[model samples]
Every structure is written in C-alpha cells, then in structure tokens.
Target: MAGSELPQEALWQRVAGRREGVLATLGPDGTPHLSNVYYLADPATRILRLSTTTGRAKGRNLLRDPRAALYVPGEDFFNYTVAEGRFEVAVASVTGEPAIDELHAVHAASGAAGDRPAFDRRMIRHRRMLVRAEITRLYGLVHPAA
Candidate 1:
C-alpha cells in the first residue's frame, strides 16, 4: 500500500526490462537481511525467479521462513515495484540440477554474464537453490500517471 495502484500491464513493462533488485529476508533471530540479486520476472505467471546458493543467507532465510520481498526499481529511481510473497525454495537435486534450470536459460537469454552451460556448472558446484516468489502483494508506481 505504499504507492498508488498501477495497471498490471504497465507494471509488467517496468519489470520485464533488465534491472537488478533488492531482496529482503528475515534472519533466524528475526533480523532483516538485504541483498542485491539479479532476477527474472514472469509477468504472465506473476512470479519472480532468483538463483542463489543454499548456503547464502537469503536462501537459508527462505528455507527457515518462506516470507520475503523483492523490490524492482524502474529506470526512474522513484518509479519502482515491490513484490512481496512467500518463497518456494528448491535445492539442487542429486544430479546437481536446480529445479528451475530454465531460470538459468531465462537469465542467459536476458544477457547474463556467461553462457548457459558455464552458468549451470557454477550453480551446481555452488549448491544453488532456485527460488520462486509467489507474489501476495505488489506495491509501487510502475507506470507514470495518466
């Protein structure tokens, strides 16, 4: 409820573009932890996907408590979108494959740092976890006022 309501179409436009976002999670002691992470937004599904290692604080926090928030800032600083929801964290399987391997493809397709294979190898070696944020509440002014 922080910003004025924005149309979903406009909101998705702001999100679909390339941008890093701030993710906030709660520590075991109820302290807040924030991290800057690259993300993929599926406006069609209203889900946000992020890749992280299981040993990382954000991933650990998600496992302990599913609640979290991802704030995506628009090209204009003041225009931003915050998607708050519960996380579905899936640790890599025995084959060293994170559940949302397609997420790697998405990132790669979006011009990620390296090739998909290299990214996959890195994620596997690091015990990566794929997190899907099921948005419960969205906030911010993703679009300009008419």
Candidate 2:
C-alpha cells in the first residue's frame, strides 16, 4: 500500500480538529486492545497528549508498557492518518490550572460538551494522567476510488 507523508502542521491540524481517536495497547492476554480517547496534540514537539482517569486499563497498561499506537481517521473515512508512536507515561496526580484551562478552551471550541457543568464533572471525576506520545513513525493513507 502506497502512503503519503503528512507534514507536521497538517498532522497537528488534523488531530486537533478530530473529535475522537482510537488508542491501541497490548492486553493482559497479549491481544491488541483498543479504546476511544480525546486527545490534544502539540505539533511543535510532535507529542500527542492524552488525558484519562489514572486507574483505567489503558493507564495501567501504559504503566506496564509505554509502547502504543494512535489512529485518527479522516472524517470522510476514505482518508486517514495512522501514527505508530511511543511515550513515557507519567502519573499526573494533580491537574494543573493551566491544563484544565486549555482543556476548557479546546472543549468549548470543539463543541465537544453540551454544557459546562457536565464537562467539568467528567474532567473532575477522572484522575488525569498525561500520555505524551512521540511520533516515531507516521504515514497518511488515502483510499483511491474503485
């Protein structure tokens, strides 16, 4: 399969605009496990930041193994970006004001939440941990018309 190289700027824009992405990790049984996540991408550093509750399976898996894969498919389904990445997991116990502020701003802009209270509750209940993924390998796939 032929693929195109997506520039850094393009990759950031695409990931930032997307609503959800699938995170792939290895299960306890050695099977590939997938979960949907809301992420923030810093194209400048080529790092993808994912926030989740600290005690989840994904979080636990990262604690055991740092290797992971992130896939953000295009809205059109025919075009998508796949990134095989790796990160060093850090347990972020306390959520900083700056991070929450940025999350609020991005959430508002994306229209991800229907209301502020609901969003705030969701963020609060979940123990926030940051998964900083460095893009080790990236490729863009465009499915041609049949």
lDDT, each prediction: 0.75, 0.68
Worst 10 residues of 2 by lDDT: 92-101
lDDT of 1 by residue, 1-146 (tens): 24566876666656656458999999999999999988887767877788888898998999999888887887676688787877898876544254747557456755763765666666677787888877767777744443
Worst 10 residues of 1 by lDDT: 93-102
State the lDDT of candidate 2 residue by residue for 1-146, as single tens digits: 45456675676667756657899887777677788987767656777776665588888788777778888988567677767777766553334445554455545545664565555556666755557788777766655555
Error of 2 at 124 (Å): 8.9
**Best TM-score goes to which candidate?**
1
Off by over 4 Å in 1: 1-3, 96-100, 110-122, 142-146
Clashes of 1: 0
